[model samples]
Target: MERLINIDNGGTLTDICVWDGEEFSFTKTLTTPFDLSQCLFDGMAKASTDIFGEEDLPRLLHSTRHIRYSTTQGTNALVERKGPQIGVLTDSPTLAEELRTGDASAELFDDLVGSRVAVIDADRDLEELSQDIVRQVNRLTTDGAARLVIAMADREKERTVKGVLLRKFPRHLLGSVPILFTWEFTPDAVRGRRVWSGIINSFLHPTMERFLYNAEHRLRDHKVKNPLLIYRNDGASSRVAKSVALKTYSSGPRGGLEGTKALSSAYGLEHVLMIDVGGTTTDVGSVKNSTISTDRRGSIRGVPVSFAMSNVHSSGVGGSSVIALRNGVITVGPESVGAAPGPACFGFGGKQATITDVNLLLGVLDPDTYLDGGFSLDAQRSRAVITEVIAGPLGISLEEALIRMEAAYFERMSTSFADDVVDAETTTVAAFGGAGPMSACGAARIAGVRRVLVPRMAAVFSAFGIGFSDIAQTYEANIAGLSANEFAATKTRLRERATRDMFQEGHEIGECRLEWSVVQEDAEGQLLSEDSYSESDPQPSASAHHAMLTLTARFELPHASIPQAEATEKSPAVSSSTRNVRSTAAQVDEVPVFDLDTQKAGAAGAGPAIVEGPYFTARVPQGWKFDVTVAGDLMLTDTIEN
Candidate 1:
């Protein structure tokens, strides 16, 4: 494999993993939310500096084969409702009503569409309907509609509306909004799903389009040979232009699952669970029998959307999540003070009490060495916030407040694994991300999980995972019948389209491994049967409820294998130091601090001990034992016999 760079952008930090062909190394940088491209380049500069002992972005980009990117920005935007105002134009009242059904849909609808929805009559005179559309478009836009979605079932009506909108609102017009038709995304017969696909894609489009294209153009200017490949939720990659926005949602977490799945296979783990704790949320997913769980009809933030999404659940609790007393009972987050003013300990004028402050105040994290000593954490700022927001209001001492805050924070994360991690007793928890290792043991124990694994590159594992993905393009067409003529025509069309897309990606049809799959979905959208046929095989018969037939063209890319750590027939490296940490308000103990980088094969130690990775930290509780795997990853097992 040529030199590869995989980037995972989180709300608090951006992780960069570089494969210099000889070895894999990673780095972390603070996220610049105002302009995501800034951090993208900054991380590259840092990686280049690490590789060459000085910053040289041009040389790094020129030598790179592919730069695959994934981010939690879409996930965070949806969670915070921090996207553009979208207006829906639907002629079907049933679909309109269905779009806003129940509490979850209702809440999302109010944010995405609200009163900006314009219901039109299909039977109205062409002139009158066009006039009404113009007025509605103007009204919706006048009332804060940044984008518009058309969700009409009839294709002809949709075309007519499209014609009317384009004529009335030209693309070149200064105030005209980009209009998306539901059919453009999918050919689903399900009314609400089609609309949701459009709504979500439209909602996530602007931010992704703006930042991704900006970064891609900047890379091009730097003489980078390849266009940016977006690591998607479905474990395939496409260039930014060819990628769909909704698929980018939760893509970061999906990358984590990929990394976890790879390590699970290496470790021979049967059932495994991944907890990727970033700044804004704790993304949890399960891997079983070498397969990463995914949903055909994916849910984003508990609201279903028409997409193939990896079954990763994101909770709004993390290291940067606010920890507060509501009615004297602790409550976790739905709101986060992201990178701009990260945690109070970051000392960027943030006053909110978070788990970062709690951990720092308790000395579980060393202020001086945090983030590879990127910057010093402010103990005073952390203490002030914890004392004011938690201790004073609850009438508790500083140490007691820290203890309570940390417990509440860990509990919130542990609860997320209730149903997410199946067979916790047998499952090995893969803990990663900036904050994942810190609470892995405590959270896993609470969730009844006894085994834990932390990658040596745990801090940047998601980016590392992106290296596992291959370039793939999938095309689907709703087949009208099983007649050979109809099937042939559809296959021809899909092949032609795929050929064009792959050509744009600088790959030819000959280079890609293609296969055809047929699926039959009933009236209720449940699958009846499915089968696959190769290019050489005869076409397989579809079931009576045949709905959509999909064709996948995959270009197999080279992947990096896990490195083998040389065995050492020696005792674990002794702790270079010890520090006093408060296990409780009244209890303080000096525990050994073992740096994973210095640990040897078969290195083993028991907690309460602090295990520090390059950019992350793990606090091994008293009952757990930390063992260094031959692969150099840390494995924390509960010695308490759960």
Candidate 2:
């Protein structure tokens, strides 16, 4: 059987999903942030053992037709400020002026500068600017900046600066530091966003380069001939060497969005809200009319950039989120214990109380069956931490504190839903991620969502989503004149460039699918209107004129074939055991606990039940009933309403 492997390297866990023609196998291992490739191989090895009954790395790599990877490392590095120090060089004095006056743009500038970086102002004159660039490069490098970004406000100045820098410091030189040009990274009309994008990419370059290159070398060592495909925030995959670091921000959440789109289409749902609760964050996204929503000017950690990506809103509530009592109120995390120590239940020296610990305390998670018994939970350790940190501080019993903490966790999750997905005409809530199933019911109830669907592979759903992605490249060009002819000519040019680039990447022209769109902007460059056009459509008329036009061309290559499991009829539900789980209505009740794998399609059960899987546990509250679809999806609905 042909094999396809996909992996999502998250902040805490590195999840692997493998498709061996007829069946799917999924597993998770701890992420080694110091060397992500370690976890990548470890997870792959575990999946290999499950598939082939042996942990032979080279054989698995050689047999695999494709290996797709996604990671949260870029976002994590930016959030933690762990990347290399960078310096910015601009032709205008406005950056310095803004820094002095503390303008809105200056806030973003400050975010880029951080503590170890510096900014240098240069004059527009070619000669003077060239000298200034040299002086600043020397000064910044002396100050320990390993990377430099050039972001001139004026297009001519930017061109001159890039030319001067390249001529002065050729990349082949032994002492040459890596230099990046803002326009090369992004030519968006928004100067600040373009500059920030360049800076962010520069900061993430070294780490991404190291990890991705190391992974590729490891693949080579294992006799894997296919290029390592990296996931992008635009819901596509690209060769690792061709991918931009900035385009990978929020890529893990983007994979979830892609999977949600597929599920939405297969289940015939008009609108779906997807919530992915991982170890460190809960990402929420919406899909309408079978299309994932996208934002062209998406922001990372509140700093806007011009890269188009899936519109996913992330909150700091997850399974491993640190839970504590702050100022007489229960608080769930924006901070996480992550996988190193994990939750108190992991017994890896973690002392903090987390949502995972609360689930253990409430008897929702089966200690003996967690991770298919690969790892066992330390209930005593969980109890000790919760008793001291949460229960004692709140002057409540363990169960009461557990219930309150759960309420707080779900409240924060529900607020994110209300903020990002409530008004979107959502018909179903698709929950995935290691912690997603555990929190889905309560989050859905609080958000007034009536239907919830948890796929059989809910825990490794993002990695599963990566299995559906295509290899794609996007190109953009700014139209100089706002004429119909200009728009058409620009589109032609960009399409040609895109086709050429993809061809160089080894994709044939016939195998590529091209999509086109135009962005219209006013004199001030504020967005006026954006529309998609086809090759057969007439040129946009001059009467619908705009100050500037930006054209985008997307080239898509087909993805590998993924087997779709057929849905079967519902069967009578059976339980392996009973556990007392705290209901959303604030009552502890003994609920039937069903194993996800053992329960066949057509199996049906009611709320106030626990559905345990290898990686996640779904808590069905009092008012709900869950049925197993033939496709192996657990469909949970409000019993009274449905």
Candidate 3:
């Protein structure tokens, strides 16, 4: 039997799933952020022992056909502030100061205006900037810079600009530099996404590099040779860690979304909502028209940014959300009962009445059979604390107090989705995490969702998504111009770079595609909203002057009627897409895909279905689905299932 293993490191939990042709198993453990591989190996040891026995562990683990992983390494770096001071090289000298601007209403220290790392104008003489580069490098190095990111003003000029940079700082010297270029991170012409990509690379690569290096070394010692395929927020996988941009900070959540989409198909649910509540927060996303939506200008860490991600709303409420009476107001979490002291029921010396305590008080969770009987809970102690802290403060009966607490927590979680998603469509909500199903019913009622699907082994859903991922890598170049041929040439260059990188890593070339993007806007006129007009309320038709790109991968490219610079001159638009356009592959009537049923027959699909593996289940909801058409993507469809 061809065995498949998937591991997902979430904010609060480390999930694992294994498939052995005939059977599947799932496992969940508390995440160890300070040291990630420790948790991975620990979970691996248990799963291996369970399936292969202690004696056959060696061949079983090492000989597994594939081992996939999705981690929060980049998120950790952002939280820990362990990134490098990037020296931005922009096309225009005036754009350098955009980094220093901060939001006025936020308490973020780094968000202060004029707090930019540093900037260098590429328009200035190379000789002058090279000296500045050395000086900046020295200063950043002294100030504990982990990597160096170089993002130019316009990435389309990569070929012409890279030559000048190569002469100034040779690629061999970059071992000491660890440089990231804007074009290299994202070649498309949007200034914001390009800048965001550079910042993520500058800030996260150092930490990821160290953590992955250690993790890989540990795996090597265990004789596992399969290269770890890391997950991206874009729902893709890559092993060329440093070369790509760190846009997929919420990759773990994306995996859960992928799983939900798969499961929804199996249940034949189209429109659905995906809820993943872990230790820290609850992430809610919708699946419409058998696809998940995308956020183009999404914000992360309170930073106004642009990156393609599943439309998700997150709240500071979750399984580990700490419950407390502050100023006599019954409040539950923004703080958590982490793995260390766990909850009041764990008998681990925690005194705080947490969500777990409330769940125990309501009989939603059994003390004797928590975690599939692996861990035991102390119901009496939990109730004692809840009664003393929550019920006593609210002057209500124990049952009433539990009802109030659970209702409030669910209300808070449900409201997050209420404001974002469009209701009145056939929607199904897939719930996971340690406390997901227990709280999902309440949340679903509030969100007006009709049905809820809790898959088998939902606790380790993320790990199952990892097994369904493919071995992949992405390459981009900075290209800015009005010429389609120039854009086409840039695509060719990026593909070549991808090919060279794969060859160096000893990976066989499977399928390759060329993609490009540029800014564009719709020219249609605008229509008035219902509030403005009386009876004939019509949807707005006026297209916003937004950045747009035309991307095609393995698809025929439409000949441009005008040059790229001219195209943008009249039309102010910038797009972020990764569609391949120049491949020899012929366009067919349609493409083939693997759906939930296909995965059960032992094949991964491009449609919605639940992939029930040993350690986890990937619930692929029909409406929130992904495809391989645009190079590859986890796209959200606007078409709601009626």
Candidate 4:
């Protein structure tokens, strides 16, 4: 094992974590939304500077064994409805109508493929069908269709229609809109899963493609030997070309889940509820027995998709999420200011009121020391925005508004945790991200969680989590019939495909640990059963069922050491300094701040205090005890008994 660097790109910040075979070091940079690659390289340069004490990109890149990346931008885009307008074309009218139907997808279907659907007749002559498709494409493009998805009844029909479109609208045609064939993604028999998967993938394609390929090309130019690996929602890393854009959804949160799994194993804890509060969303996930909650067929906004992924819910409320008084009710997000003009406190011309602004005004955040004082936070700007958007409208004092805003934010997070976590008493909440620790105690207490663990690397925790992923990929093919020849043929095809794909990932077929399985799904695409595939009898039961041959190839990598509690005797933690903070509407209190850097392992502290790290801070409010281990792990346990 050598240098493995993990990068988690958020809407507002890009976190970078470097593991040099032994110790871990990390840094972060404000995201450049205008050009994501800019922030990607910016963070890399900072990592290089932090490691070698100088900005040495070449030296850093050459020595690195692997660099894995994950991002929450796709999740943010889907939540904000910020992707390109999409159009859908299908051979079956039933499929086209179902695609536009707003039942399973709700308003998401209307926002993406609504009214932009076209149907073509498969029984028509080839020339006539081609003419119909061309007209539909023209009409859809004219109706502001930025992208297109071709959804048919099956792969056979889908591939046939794709050929017609490619012939008419050749790639050389610069004006031709980009198109996606749904069957190319998955062989799921359900039309809804196949079409929605294509639509979502097409929506996120441009962003992921532009950023990843550009970054990969630049890395190649710099003589970086390994291809850039993308961390997927399936708890593995694969090349950009091999990964699906829809799989990138909520992947950053999945990275946080991986880190939570590590912490659970190290600390010997069970049932961890994760609250990953990033800039735009507070992603909630759960871990039982060191395993993340997962769905065999994942859903996006409740619309089922054709991928198995971790069960993480993205709540709209976050640090930079717009907080306002709507209809006399405090509303938290669904929209965000993002990184460019983050929150009002960021002083990036953002006039929006957000939790960041509230925290700044309440003294929980030091304007001069936030982000390690890298950027100045404008307390006055925060105050002005809050007064205009929240206080003035509600006819309340700014101080009162701040207090209300804090309660609303914590309430939102607590509500999300309540939905995900069943036994709050047994489950320990693990909070991570730049804004995660600020009110972790308050949120957990509200949710009735008795404990919270804020990792030392909480600020860059997601990026650090990506280090646990192994290089892996899966290939599957639908079995045409239950006959022996057909099953053997499908098995041979998937095996050959897996071998070729893994070879591109820099591993030979023999070197990979391969697993073969057969999966059967009902007509509605619900998973029925799975059985290990044996070469002796590759055929499925003669009964009628839709089966698929799946082959998984993985290159297992070494994981970093699991954390162990330090041996030092626990004692009261010494205070580094004190900050004047507004704890209530009536008065300000002197809050003792514990700088973990100056404290020894096993040092303990109690409530009404702040545990401040270089990149993150946690509020140890009343009724909680905070402790640090030798490896810089921070744990907060509720002092209140059950």
Give residue 427's error in model 1 in angstroms. 1.1
lDDT, each prediction: 0.85, 0.79, 0.57, 0.84
Taking the tens digit of each residue's C-alpha lDDT, what string does model 3 give over 1-642? 557777888766788777875566667776776798888877776677667656355666765765567777777567656566544444455454444345621332242212334555555576776676566555655555545555565544444456665776576754576666666555445565456656665667667777777877877787777666566776666663422436547787777777766665544566767778777678777776657666644556655454556667677788778877788777777887777677888887777777777765554444555665667889887878888888888788777777677667878677756665466356666677666655665566566664565554567766665554544454433232326566456545655665666554445344434343433332211111111211122222223343333232231111101111111112111212112111111321121222222221112232133222222222233343322111111222222333
Clashing pairs in 2: 567-630, 567-631, 568-630, 569-602, 570-602, 571-602, 571-603, 608-620, 608-621
The per-candidate count of clashes, in order, stands at 0, 9, 71, 0
Candidate 2 lDDT over residue span 18-94, tens digit each: 88766788899988877899999999899889878988777788888778899888888877777777777765556
Better of 1 and 3 by lDDT: 1
Which of the predicted structures, 1 or 3, would earn the higher TM-score when compared with the native?
Answer: 1
Superior by lDDT: candidate 3 or candidate 4: 4
Q: What is the lDDT of residue 516 in candidate 4?
A: 79
For model 2 the TM-score comes to: 0.91
lDDT of 4 by residue, 1-642 (tens): 568989999998999999987888899899998878889889999889989999998888888888899976687678768889999988776765565466758578888877888888866888998899889988899899999998877777787788888898888862657888888778777788888899999998887887899989989989898889999998899999988888898899888999999888877787998898888888898888988888878998788788888989887777889997889998888688888789998888998998889888888888888877778888989988999998999999988888899999888878878876688777899999999999788888888888899888899988888889988988777774647776777777877888898888999988888887877887777778888876566466634366777778898876786557547788889998898778787778898998887888889988888888868878887778988887777789888874
> Sorted on lDDT, highest at the top, how do the candidates line up?
1, 4, 2, 3
lDDT of 1 by residue, 22-112 (tens): 6886898999988889999999999998889999988888888999999877876887788899988878766657878888888998888
Candidate 3: stretches off by over 4 Å: 53-56, 80-97, 100-116, 119-146, 155-177, 240-248, 296-299, 302-307, 395-399, 476-488, 501-507, 510-642
